[model samples]
Target: MILAAGLGTRLLPLTKKIPKPLLPIIDKTLLQIAIETACKANPNIIVINASYLSGKITEFLGAHDFGVEIKVSVEPDILGTAGGIKAVEKWLSKDDFGVINSDIIATVDWDALKKIHKNSNATATLMLRDNPDPAIYGPLCLNEKGRVIRIVNTKNRDLSGAEPLLMFTGVSMLSPAIFERIPAGRAVEISSEIYSPMVKAGEPLYGYVTQAEWTDAGTMENYHKAVMARFATCKTSIGMTAKSLKYVTIRPPVHIDTGVYIRAGSTIGPNVAIHEGSVIGASVILKNCVVTPRSNVRSGAFLDGEVI
Candidate 1:
């Protein structure tokens, strides 16, 4: 299951037009990448929860067929992370299911994590990371044996080096039993209401850390970082139908979608994604930016680290 219903308030204006799930990562939307990644686990179906601007998500799913089956849990009132999953209890009760946050770009090994979950006999197993500075990222305090004992405060802690902490990677394995604890059709937070108390009650909540490339694209800085990393690896990909004038500098890692018109003398690249039907005027320089679909970029403008 993918939790994609969040309003993405931090990503304002950009998400003002498109939902977070549909945010582009490299050449694919975040929803597509997440679905493609989770499909590697060989699950029978993928369930996504959508709320903000759900029509676009519904339209995308209706038109495109991912290799695996997809079911959307639409929230008329914006059910939160826990509530959204709780509503899908019937679909997930058959077996333990893995949940992924749509805003994050990760390459987690689901098969390996499943084995660890089975071996540890945990009710909920979260994908963790041994980040150097767990202070900035919320910390998941774990015992030597890998059992998560508690969730630290929700702020950037300036703790000393002696206390080791692992950050929650927003991916977790949850058994059907978790549903019984959370009510359906109500907004509820996962960490505060579910995992924290479960850990205190000795319910075998474990943390499994791995060295996967994870980019939490919830904020602009991190989103920019994710774009730069992916562009460095896969480079730029321009749609064949995207029209661009001659002498325009097309830098690597920039993704220009179909129907985009780029005027002459404009430079774009190194972490930029211009969505379909957008018009980029002459002499414009865009770097580390995302131009939403059908948006018009002013002429001779320079936009850096922004979502136009």
Candidate 2:
């Protein structure tokens, strides 16, 4: 299940116009990237839960096919991570299911998590990453055996063997048993409300440590970072012919989509994504920012750390 119901309060104006999941990251929306990533796991079907602007979610899903059966679970009132999954219990309870947050970009090893959960008899297996300050992000402490013994300040089991705390990547593989812990028709967070109590009860919860690239695109700054991360392997990606871009100094890692017109003498890049139909005036300097579709950047304007 892909959790796309959050209000995206942190994203502000960007999200005010479009749902967080629908926010574009270069060529694809965040939701599309997440769904494609989930498809790598070879699941029989994909389920997405939407609330805020649920119509757009449904419309977007209908426009594409990710080679898997995709279904949208619309929530009249926002049901959080736990409740979202619980509401779709009937479809997911057939077997263990995977859940991913639409606001995050991650490369989780789903097969590894499935194996870990199956072999360890764990009720749920979470994808965790090594962070210097897990406490700041709410830690998920794991033992030497890779069992999650604590979440944030709550610990249900003894933690004498706890390893360095890790960060939750918001990607998990859960068994049907988790449904019993989540109440229906309500907002229930997975960490404090569900997992923490399960930990205290000795229910096996495991962690799959991964060294994959991940970024939470819930905030504008982080969203910019996520877009920049996608260009790490390639220098610059131009959606159209080079003849259309003349006298423009494009630094590496810059992405200029089709239909975007950049005037002469403009410098763009070192982490920039100018979407389709945007116009960049002459002598404009854009760095570390995103230019939304159909926008007009006035001449002589300089943009940094912004989304316009």
CA lDDT of each prediction against the hidden true structure: 0.83, 0.86
Off by over 4 Å in 2: 154-163, 239-244, 247-249, 263-265
What TM-score does candidate 1 get on C-alpha atoms?
0.91
Q: Could you tell me how far off, in angstroms, the CA of residue 191 lies in candidate 1 after the best superposition?
A: 0.6
lDDT of 2 by residue, 1-308 (tens): 89999998998877776888998888789999899889989999899999998999999989997889998899999888898899999889989989999989988888898999999988899999986664456777888798888776643333344457688888999999999989887889888888989889878999999989888888888888888777776457898677766688888788888898999989998789998888999999999888877789999998887888
* Tens digit per residue, CA lDDT, model 1, 102-153: 8898998998789878889888899998866664777777888889876776
User: Model 1: which residue pairs collide?
Assistant: 236-253
- lDDT for 271 in candidate 2 is 86
Task: Look at candidate 1 and tell me the lDDT of residue 89.
Answer: 84
